[model samples]
Target: MYLFLNGEILHKEEAKISPFDHGFLYGMGLFETMRTYSGHPFLLNDHLERLQLGLDTFNIDLDLQKLDISGMIASLSEKNGLQDSYIRLNISAGEGEIGLRTTPYNHPNILLLQKELPPLMPLREKEAVLLKLRRNTPETSVRLKSHHYFNNIAAKREAGDDPGKEGLFLTKEGYIAEGVTSNIFWISDGKLYTPSLETGVLNGITREYIMELAGTLGIPSEAGMYMPESLLKSDEAFFTNSVQEIIPIHTFEGRTFPGKRGRIAQQLYSHYERDAQVLFSKNELHRS
Candidate 1:
């Protein structure tokens, strides 16, 4: 495999990082996961926008506007010989002294990694279980897709290795937070509902886009602190992320849901498929 690190593409095994890098030393870094459809990056601008916000919050100095991100993705795609792919754009604070510093990190390491992906199918299903491990509070005011990921890793282990199952997490206070690696949502009475960001859930990009899609379909959406029992009253439920898009939950807490057969899940996913086909940046979609 090959990766784009700094300004050049190199074999993954050949790429190197300093042991003193703050990102390595102290987990001071951020990353964004994106997917390409027919070689076009869906929601490229929005992902970068979120990435920029994370960089600002981390005190990592990097100007994305000066970089040709699309061009980079295209180059990596050609080099890796994959069109449908998973992309992780990472930026980490460069070398720093042993102690923590309040000063901004001027030099940061940027990396782009990709992996082949089969064409995503709409309404793909997964089973969810309430995890015993509670969601951890974000280190900052809002959660950034940063190097601090042990919480998610632990949740994944607790959920076990069933690829078709996703572990749902509740906040320390027992309010529904989100899936281990995705945001959770459910539909009831023609309305869509999800755990609010106040619950310390990561404000996922796809989560935001799904809410937008709901509005376009005239579906009222609400976000608030919810409990596991709420799924019992739900007609259908699904999970969302940049890569998986919309994953209909087939079962939760021993209760069965409509899953892929759900009317609302079908409608939202159909619209999601149509938009992904056109492959416009989320910003462009909003402008029109």
Candidate 2:
């Protein structure tokens, strides 16, 4: 695999970052995992916008105009022979002396890695277990994907090595926070239900799109803090992420969903796929 580091691409084995980087020393970094459709990145703008916001929050003034993100993604995909692919785009405060002083990063490290994926199929179904880990709201602001990942890592370690199962985290208040690495949703009598962002949950790009799709597809949706047990009120449940657009949840802590593919999920997924095709056609973005 080739990794786009800084402004150059290198084999993964040769990729390296300074050990003194603040992102490594103090967990001061940001990342976005995205996927491609016909060679164009899905929601690249949204991901970049979020990355910029995080960089801004820390007073980092790296001018993104100097970089061609779309070009890089497309070129990287072509170079790696990836029409259908998984991408991990990461940026961290570059080499900084030890300690957590509020100093600006003079040399931020930006990297992108691409891997081939089979043609995207419906994510099908998976099972989940409620974890004992309590997700507390950030003492600062709402969560964005960041380097402080120990809580999530710990939860996943406890979740064991079941590929078909995932762990769900509940807020310290006992409300459903999110999945280990994806945002979760459920359909209750055709109305979509998910946790509100006010809970300091990670602002997921796909999570936002699902709600937009619900409106486009005319499925009523609501986001707010509800008891974790409230998931039982739904007929079907699913998780959303960039790579796996949607995966049905057969059961949550033993509460089985209504069916393999619920009506609302089927509609939303169908519409999403159709819309993407139309988007590619209209934009004429497929790369060879």
Measured by lDDT, the strongest candidate is 1
* Candidate 1 per-residue lDDT over residues 1-288, each given as its tens digit: 999999899999999999999999999999999898888887888889889999999999899999999999999999999888999999999999999879999999999999998766657899998899999999988999999999999999999999799999999899999999999999889889999999999989889888887786689999998988887789999999999989999998889999899999899888777676555455444654
Instruction: Score residue 248 of candidate 1 by CA lDDT.
Output: 94
TM-score of each: 0.97, 0.92
Question: What TM-score does structure 2 among the candidates reach?
Answer: 0.92
> Where's the lowest-lDDT run of ten residues in candidate 2?
279-288
Residue-level lDDT tens digits of model 2 in 211-276: 876776578999999886779877889888878778788888668885446877787777667554
The whole-model lDDT of each prediction reads 0.90, 0.79
Local error of candidate 2 at 11, Å?
Answer: 1.4
Backbone atom clashes (below 3 Å) for every candidate: 0, 0
Backbone clash tally (model 2): 0
